[model samples]
Target: MFNSIGIPGLIIILVIILILFGPSKLPKLGRSIGESMKNFKDSTKDIMDDDEINQDEKATKENK
Candidate 1:
């Protein structure tokens, strides 16, 4: 169902949020979202790196 919401739907949603929150709050909201996204990305990267390190260790031990 969510996949059906295309560009037009997103624009409408943004417009509604703008109306509800007012222009003054948008910056704060955007900043909060940006920070959250950054944290999520950083954590994901860390998890991926850990997985790679574990896989490398497993391969090395198996070879030895």
Candidate 2:
């Protein structure tokens, strides 16, 4: 279903975002989104790291 969105759909979305945010605000918005994504990913990685899984043990379990 997602793959069905082609160039036209992308163009429409781009136009909408441009109209809503305007050209001047686009870069600022992009940076904010990037920072938010980075923070989210960083926090997620920290939580996942706390689980402290061993790669070798996981591989052996998967092999079983």
Candidate 3:
């Protein structure tokens, strides 16, 4: 989707966001977005780890 949105496109989007949200709100908005991204990343990692553990358990049982 964003494959075509290069540096200029990103700059334009940022400018628009700044205009809409203003400088003061930008920091708060950025912090919230960062936190959300971190949470999403952690959740995905936990899910992947669970899948690996389950696969390992299945393999061990099959070997026995």
Note each model's CA RMSD in angstroms. 2.4, 5.3, 1.8
lDDT of 2 by residue, 1-64 (tens): 6589988999999999999999999999999999999999999998778665666678889999
Q: Pick the candidate with the highest TM-score.
A: 3
Backbone-clash count (model 2): 0
Candidate order by lDDT, decreasing, is: 1, 3, 2
lDDT per prediction? 0.98, 0.91, 0.97
The parts of candidate 2 lying over 4 Å away from their true place are 53-64
lDDT of 1 by residue, 1-64 (tens): 8689988999999999999999999999999999999999999999999999999999999999
Taking all chains together, each candidate's TM-score versus the true structure is 0.80, 0.76, 0.83
Which pairs of residues clash in candidate 1, taking residues 3 or more apart in a chain or in different chains? none
The 10-residue segment with the lowest total lDDT in model 1: 1-10
Measured on C-alpha atoms, candidate 1 has an lDDT of: 0.98
1-64 in candidate 3: lDDT tens per residue? 8789988999999999999999999999989999999999999999999999999999999999
C-alpha lDDT of residue 13 in model 1: 98
Root-mean-square deviation of Cα positions for candidate 2 versus the true structure, in angstroms: 5.3
Superposed model 1: Cα runs more than 4 Å off: 1-8
lDDT of 3: 0.97
Candidate 3 local Cα displacement, residue 39, angstroms: 0.4
Which sections of candidate 3 miss by over 4 Å? 1-3
